[model samples]
Target: MTTYDYLIIGHGIAGATLAHELRRRGRTVLVLDTYQTDSASNVAAGLMNPVAGKRFALAWRADDFLTAAATFYRELEQRFGQQFFFETPILKLFSSVAEQNTLLARSADHPWQNFVEELAPSLPPAPGVRQDFGGVRIRRGGYLAVRELLVALAAEGLEQGWLRRETFDWNQLVVGPASASYAGDVHARRVVCCEGAAAVHNPYFDWLPLTPNQGEVIDVECSGLADTQVLNKGAYVLPLGAARFRVGATYRWPPFAEGTTEEARAELSQRLASMTDQPFVVLAQRAGVRPAVRDRKPLLGVHPATPVMSILNGFGSKGVMLAPLLAGHFADVLEGHAELWPEVNILRYHALYVAARKEGGFSS
Candidate 1:
């Protein structure tokens, strides 16, 4: 039996990146995942923005995340011999005068100045884009071919003999004070759960504030649309080719339904229409659940009672930007070289874990 140094569950962005970092450090690792179709990482458009939302507020640690992501993804592309990261400016078309003012205030003279380019005379008419109110072009933004990256990572992991393509069976998992094992055969010194949105159902860590949000995106073929930049309104139009674009992302909360919905399709089409009157044809639609947290920060750290178990999830839609830096931090913590950042550390939710345990959610 191989006693791996670390066992990782789920091969989504969080797991793959962390595994890559660990392996780079010469650690023996094993990763188990089925790579489910509904996994958010597969469907996500992989948009990375420095300043977002109606308020045009800067993201937390925006500079650090973008810098790390640029370096990390480029490294992965070179190592895997494939291109997955696309660097381009995101043109944010304003919807209202208030939003235009917000952009000016955020970019004119703020720490966010470097990440934004305020439009001159604002709202210049593009070939096929509609910008009623002025907009701003964000400099530190891009897209990642998320599914392709995973495929490349999977191939690399297989060739390296560290990956198993199978669903993890918790029923067969046994954890001790210092280690964890699966089916009484697979063994590792520590287990890190990177199970994406499914972590909400994980009995060991369900006590934490891991909220799931379902998002949907559609691929379309619209001729004549500019292919150099990503256009944004309420939704975004990401250019994939000369005549191909990926528009998406309808947010559905609560029930967190599986698969796609007709309502989502209509909503997406309407969003596209709002941005442009282009007569594009929908090629495909994909939906996945994001492992988001109520606090809008990631979840990381070891379990309260079981030091053998740890979690690295809750990235939500910002997975592309957040995964790189956070993974490096946790990997450093794992190697005893550093500690987990307080804001993202799962220990902050230890009280909730204990409360849920007392309420009979799971045995300690």
Candidate 2:
């Protein structure tokens, strides 16, 4: 049996970053996971856009999160010897006059004005990208090489003997007051579950309001499109160098089956057409479920009754932007150095667990 300070379940963005933070703090860790092609982290485009939605409302704590994320990825680059994060301007194209007016109104303000560079009606923002609507150049925007980073992290973990490529059986997880034991061969002081959408089936944390959505992205090879910037209106086109781009995505809710579908392919093809009429070839299509939440917040904290088991999930599409900083914050809380932020802490939903217990319809 090998006992560690922590056992992290999942190698997605959240688990990888958290494990790295803990190990950097000199804690021994073992990551238990098997690669899944359709997992969000594997198929993610890793887009980071602060100027979001039709109303141009900024993402929550956008400034703080953006700064921290940049620093974090740069630090990862130093540690991993690869460039994972790329900083580039995003060209936000306007679809209609009303949308353009809203952008103008926002740009007229002090901070909003500082974040954008005026563009003359989408005048060929990038090669092969549309030029009809004129767009605003957003300063704080970029993409993380999500899939590549995970592969690298997995390789590193495997080389270091801290990552086991296998499926985790729930029946084998035993939680104690001060520690956890798994599969008869692993013991840890605490177990942190970062299992993405799979948490819906977790007996210990299923009370959470996790709203998983099916998202799809398509890869294409366009000879003319440049890799210097990202383009967004209804959908996004992220350049992957060598004239390749990843275009996406379509969000599907419940009653939807998992995996890639023809409908999504057509829908994305149409959206890509709307972005440009340039020549391109579809290289591949991917489908994954994003672990979203009703309140659009990341879930963090330990099980109420089972103190040795905790979770960090529901990051949805913002995992790249939110995980790095939040992992550090949560690490601080786990180490008793700081209190968990009220907005994202799982303690807010303890009442739901209590209510479920009273109803006698829940799992451990």
Highest TM-score scorer: 1
- Taking all chains together, each candidate's TM-score versus the true structure is 0.97, 0.96
Q: Flag regions of model 1 displaced more than 4 Å.
A: 105-107, 120-124
Model 1 agreement with the true structure over 1-364: per-residue lDDT tens digits: 6799999999999999999899988999999999788899999999998988877778999999999999999998888788999999999888888767665665657777888766643655677787777688889799999999999999988887898999988888889888888987788999999999999778799998888889999999989677788999999899988699999898888886679999999999998888876788999999998887989999999888888899999999999999999999999998889988999998888889878978999755
RMSD of each: 1.4, 1.6
Clash totals for all candidate models: 0, 3
Clashes of 1: 0
Instruction: Assess candidate 1 and give its lDDT.
Output: 0.88
Residue 188, model 1: Cα distance from true site in angstroms: 0.6
